[model samples]
Target: MGFHTFDVDRADALEDPGRYRFCSREELVAALDIGDGAVVADIGSGTGFYTNEIAPFAGRVYAVDVQSEMHELHRKKGAPENVEFVAAEASAMPFDDDELDVAFSTMTYHEFASDASLEELARVVQPGGRVVTLDWSANGTGDDGPPVDERFALADCVDAFESAGFRTVDATGRKETFVHTARR
Candidate 1:
């Protein structure tokens, strides 16, 4: 993560259901288009909130986060049986090349939106695998999420993914959030 990471002290905010106002579990699942036996990873998973939402639909779900405290919080929250904890950064994960069927992030795209990180995603996800990202948009009013100055616009995300060798499937820049789905 390049910008300020989520503070572990305010982790309770991550668990609040109201946080779903900007991005919901349903929208994320739809964007992912998970297969019956898909192996997926939830990058920057804070407390297995969205990770738990996707685990029942996927064969395996890796909860990947750079902070051990976040994983610990997830552990305390009791994740699903199929959820695996991965304490690693987005740009440098432990997974083998072309191993993942899909990878996604919720409100975390801005933190790891560098060339190295997007390229790492392109490297890990197999061909035809999808990469879904939902985050605070630069187009949004500075009311609910991070400042617009730190967020990325829809075109920025599309360019980054395309540059990293993924093909855009769909993209929507909404009021406060932007969702993008791309295929490797």
Candidate 2:
């Protein structure tokens, strides 16, 4: 199992521009390498912040969140035309086998990182499809995000993806965050 769910009441913080300090749109899009008409999913896509940044680059972008309230907030914030909101858990998405060309998650990975979730991602993303994950690192100082005890290191992400049949393309551990790119 993963960590606890983010309290929906504090969802506003998810949209702050200062959040770019951890993960910027340019780096995220570059990490995705999304092509025209490619199918993508944003796992734990809280209020469609990063989802909006990615929608323009892909054919279909699934704004996936387990909480219905999160989806509602994204709708209120004006989700893009091609963006479809899916109220589902990261370990149990509704997409078909090998349906997604790419998938990504921001700081919310700690709440959904699990063996089952990684297996689910392997099942949904096509072979060679990229999965980019950026989240709070276990090695970080307890400055921002959840407590350091709840986060995962870049190596932890590499192990999880590898166990689920993904090839680790890159793994970087920053001061307060970690980014792991894997290919299914």
Candidate 3:
């Protein structure tokens, strides 16, 4: 299936929400290593899952998503004062150059139509800022499950980030899910 065919509504209502769940929100926040006054952007932030979780740790969070319904649901869920939702295409963020201190996306990289999204990611993050990604592993063992072809391996994500001018920092082996950290 083509990337544009992805149905955010149907996908959000899947029987197994755990498949899309983050491993440990606190761990992710720690890995980000942001100070209390840093600005973070959560790309493909669905229903404020990571947005709300990371808000308490950062100065502000930009919850960017292509789906307005998801953004509305995120707002209804009672986001923190530090969170802001912006309807954004994955390939083009709305922020100015180097405006963000950290960038995060959970279970979202594979949903992008092409490398345009990575370019956008690199564009908004400042030099030496961190970019963290959590996604379904390509090992075909996730409980929430991703479309076979849409799933990406750790290496694939690392290469994409590197090509976009990010330097890989660390990656969790081939677990059902993996976390990758890179720096611009």
List TM-score per model, in order: 0.97, 0.98, 0.89
lDDT of 1 by residue, 106-168 (tens): 999888789989989999999999999999999999798788898999999999999999999
Deviation in Å, model 2, residue 100 alpha carbon? 0.1
Could you arrange the candidates by TM-score from highest to lowest? 2, 1, 3
Measured on C-alpha atoms, candidate 1 has an lDDT of 0.91
Over 42-120, each residue of candidate 2 has an lDDT whose tens digit, in order, gives 9999999999999999999999999999999999999889999999988899999999999999998999999889999
For candidate 2, list the clashing residue pairs, or say none.
Answer: none
Order the candidates by lDDT, highest first.
2, 1, 3
C-alpha lDDT of candidate 3 relative to the true structure: 0.79
Residue range 22-105, candidate 3, lDDT tens digits: 557767887799976999998888787778879989998999888888877777768999898888887888899999999987
What lDDT does the true structure give each of the candidates? Answer: 0.91, 0.93, 0.79
Question: What residue runs in model 3 are displaced by over 4 Å at the alpha carbon?
Answer: 1-22
Q: Model 1, 182: alpha-carbon shift in Å?
A: 0.2
Enumerate residue pairs that collide in model 3.
19-144
Model 2 spans > 4 angstroms off: none
Which is the winner by lDDT between candidate 1 and candidate 3?
A: 1
Candidate 1 stretches with Cα past 4 Å from truth are none
**Candidate 3 least-lDDT 10 residues:** 11-20
